[model samples]
Target: MKLHVIVPLCVLFTLTLTQQTPSRDKCVCELTHSEKAFPHDRLSTVEDDASKCNGNITPQKTVELENLLLGLEKRLPQLQQDVSVLEREDDGQLSSVLSLLVVENELLEIKQLINRLNITMLGYQRLTTNTTKELVDLTAEMQELETYDTMQVVKRQNDNRRLRRDLDHCRNGHQPTTQPTEPPHGNCPHGQFQNISGPRVYTAGEYPGSYKYGAWGRDPKPGAGKKSWYWIVFLTSSNKFSNYVRLYSSLSSLIVGVSTPGNVLIHSSNPTTNTVQGPNVVLYGDALYYNCYNRDAVCRFDLSSKAVTTLQLPKGTRFNSKGNFCHLDECYLFTDLDLATDESGVWVIYTTTQDFGNLVLSKVEEPLTLGQTWRTSVYKQGVTNTFMACGVLYATRYVNKVTEEIFYSFDTTTGVEKFNLGISINKMSPNIYALNYSPVDQMLHAYCDSYMVSYKVLFS
Candidate 1:
């Protein structure tokens, strides 16, 4: 085909240089392998070639290709049935829900197709087959999807509409703002979330000076007729254990020490097994959930009955291992699993054997039972910490010894991902292993280098 479009000399020169690069050899090999496998009934041994060409491709790109090939290989047999269903759609053979699912399935396929195209284009000049028409078609399809935020906008819009309707009803049911009184001590509320004004992440120097230091604790939720109360853990006077509990009454006139009845035992079912761990703790109902030290398990300590329940994590889960939870060489102490509490219940974020080192968020349904909540295939090797607030999952990355930022968020309700949080947390200590967000007081509590600090969350 004769080209009629004008091209800048510099652009052409750069393109030529990129094409002549040695990386194109691996791309060409992959493309040729893909073509041979597409026509053959036997599965392609592309993994072998991909392994040999590892240094030539980015790790992310390699993962994308692996997942795409696996999915495509598995779904190839369903393509004919899908086509039949598409044909029968004109005759109304498919239900609305099924049809919507079909659309989603196709969108997923298109997304993988785009990834393949990206790989193919990396070796543009080396391509033996004419891919101009395919490129044009895929580009057009992507443009159509991007106009509406690639299916994410649809879900977000639907969520906003539902929330707006609920808000309208709530406004109609709005009551006078009366200060709620504190319920009697030891009367813990059921598993629930506090009503918050909005979500926020306070930057350094922006947090109010009201929150005190010298304590590491679970994020407090509104309960027991009180708007905010924290379960602060402290070491006993003997320095042999950290099983003492203190309450930080946000509403009380006094902001000093207030001891509670129950003391948390830092041992497992066997009295000899010490389960003392740090940073992450969740308050749900009358039970406090935290990961057991050196054990791949979450421990639920009951305040009323003084009973302990241990929920074991999946096999291959990291725990108490050196260099397990570190983003870089600067490692934090004893961070294996992160426990968080939202409006509804408690959740634990940890890696599983099935997720290939990716983060999995599972809901704590019972004291010992964990319900699978959500899983993202994106690897969290760069994540320094994770916490849940208002059903949304936020992750932080270590920028330096002095700074960290909330670099990622996943909205469980809408399944949306955000990457543009510029909010920064200034740390006095080089190691900050623990982070939790309190909905009732709208604060992010952090345990940094043995010092406890609270940052006020300011909503935009």
Candidate 2:
């Protein structure tokens, strides 16, 4: 019975071992933890086994991580550079903020100053007008009283005889007279002005509308070798100022963008004191004259000597854009002073508080002296541009986009004004910033929206 039981046990153990060996051969994965077993039913292929055993990481996921790392590596240099720049800028950040604050304060102060000046000008205008009226009344009364005095009449007759004798002697070249001479009136060498022809020349020069405010023309009284030369001054600073004068040997050179020997620097620094301040400019003789920066004065920049001279305008003259050329729609800024040239010489057109913003014309004499001044009835703000011809001041007004009308004239010779001249200008641009008549060529030179245009002056 013992032999039979032992044989049955050996057979049972052999069958159990056979079953376990095949199961062990079928296992494809192993676990390190003795307490855990691999989930063989959940995995069907080698890829599934790899994903299940390696914390759910796949070949595609591995490639994505590799690409992310490469991208970070590529951007690391730029990130480092940015950090360095931030570090450098941190030191000056406070100073930069303070500087901006200072600039803002300065701007505020300038605005305040302008407001104060306007108020003062208005007050002065009222006082001066009253005083002038009173003075005229007093003078008229004094004249009436003098006419009733016999002794005063006799004294006036004796004085008149002495003046006539002095004039006769001077005319006969008999003796040196001590009478002050009158300023030149620039009488018309040609016939009386009738009308102006169409544009004879229109060009944009080299800049080609890059600048909106500027002036260009041939000199009215050029130096010996500079008769054919032309000049241009662009208000490159905020369209209100410039520091140089560009010279062209000829009109062809000006149109073709040919560079001359060099440009004349009004000042080494732009928008500074004594530099050009407005678009109204004129090349007279051997000097360039323009409005002085921030002052009611005319500045002359000598081409040969490179020296600057200033002629202060009359007291109460409007400036700092308080007085500007205007139309019904808009006003041109920084046009308080308009420099013009004619057969006489250089003249300046401005407005004064005393004149109630009407046009005031003054002759600029040699050595930068103020000559005779005339007050006009035409309101300055109504005029767009003005030029002098034959001792007459011609003013233009905006008619439309394509037309400007010369509807007003003030004769400096006869102290007469005409408002129905009815002359028209055909424009190539919308605005004419500067206009002057060249006596040498009898042509009108206009700086119109960065274009240099010329028109012939037709005289009767």
Candidate 3:
């Protein structure tokens, strides 16, 4: 009976194992292809045991094999779900790496564009510098030619006058008393202004009588008493910066300087439109050139027609409320535009931030148009005031109430700066608002504290 039962059970176990073999092979294949680690050694041992059971099988061994198969079947679905999750994570990591590479490429492109722009800007700046140099050279040549023409014309006129005088003497039947040879080049009708050997002091009550008593400038075009004109700017009682100018028939008279009684002209046509300011004023030809307050513009008042015209300054120009020029204790309002007239032409001296806040001298053409501008290497901060004489610029600095010194001289023709001048203004008010050099009488005019004073400018 035991032999019969054991044989039947063994046959039944063999058939059951044979039937499950295909399914077991499929599970092994899945495990072999998997990306995750699995126990291949255990699977191999189970296969060996199943093969050995075909020859000799026991109830205990059959039951153990069945339990192992059941456990493998139960774990299969969970293993597949784990593999799906791992695949998703790997895909995400790869996508993130690609995105980082794309961002890096974009940043590199932006850097390249910025470098190219910098190179272009460098080229443009170089071109502008070369152009400026050429313009300056051309302007100098033109000025020299104009001076030559003027000298020739003056010589011809004098020669004609001498010939006419000789003819008159011949007609009178008198030997022309040998006319004294005229001074060389008719330099200055009065001796070429003498250079100062020592300081000349002036107090509130004391002043030199030789220099027109109390006058602002050496009448550049001195002719008749009516031809030599002087002007004074006074702050209105209503507003300090809002001002009107008075025209004087003669600065030679002491009454005019003391009382400032003259015709009041050129008030702000429309005070609301623009305030007429006179930090500096240059009377040239037939117009009075001045800076318009609170705006980057210059105004030309036609003395004959009584008409006004404006010329715009460069953009980003500092003016009006912008305080760059300063003196001791106070920054003079409306000092930004320094107007001057000389043999060459009228010029406006101003400081510009575009040129690193350096002094810029621009020539004013007819109708208040801006012509050529020259940028000086000297920083504007060191200069307290600037004026032009015979096309040369003199810059002064505030030393004390008693003295102001000319420390720098700029030549517009050669674009050269010199520091050889040791000239100083003596015993002047601390608030010397304006300084102008006149080539006609060779004197320096100062407007300070409602007083107009003149000094003999000594040139060595």
Q: What total of clashing residue pairs does each candidate reach? A: 1, 0, 1
Global fold similarity of model 1 (TM-score):
0.48
Q: Number of the top candidate by lDDT? A: 2
Please provide, for model 3 over 1-460, each residue's C-alpha lDDT reduced to its tens digit, 9 standing for 90 to 100: 9999999999999999998876534433443532334345644655565455333433323332332333334334434544454555545677655655544443443344344335545654674576566556555654544454533776698789999998987887765554422112112334422243221212221122212211134335443433445554444432234344456433322221222245446664534334466457766664666777567788877656777788998886778646344665666655778888765567888877778878888988876689988888776666677887656677777778777777676766667776646567763356566777766656566766654545666543
| Model 3 alpha-carbon drift over 4 Å, by segment | 1-225, 237-243, 254-261, 268-275
Which model is ahead, 1 or 2, in terms of TM-score? Answer: 2
**What TM-scores do the predictions have?**
0.48, 0.60, 0.51
Count residue pairs with overlapping backbones in model 3: 1
Q: How much lDDT does candidate 3 score?
A: 0.57
Give the CA lDDT, 0 to 100, for residue 126 in model 2: 70
Tens-digit per-residue lDDT, 281-303, candidate 1: 66667567776655888888776
The regions of model 1 sitting more than 4 angstroms off are 1-228, 234-244, 248-274
Worst 10 residues of 1 by lDDT: 197-206
Could you say which candidate leads in TM-score? 2
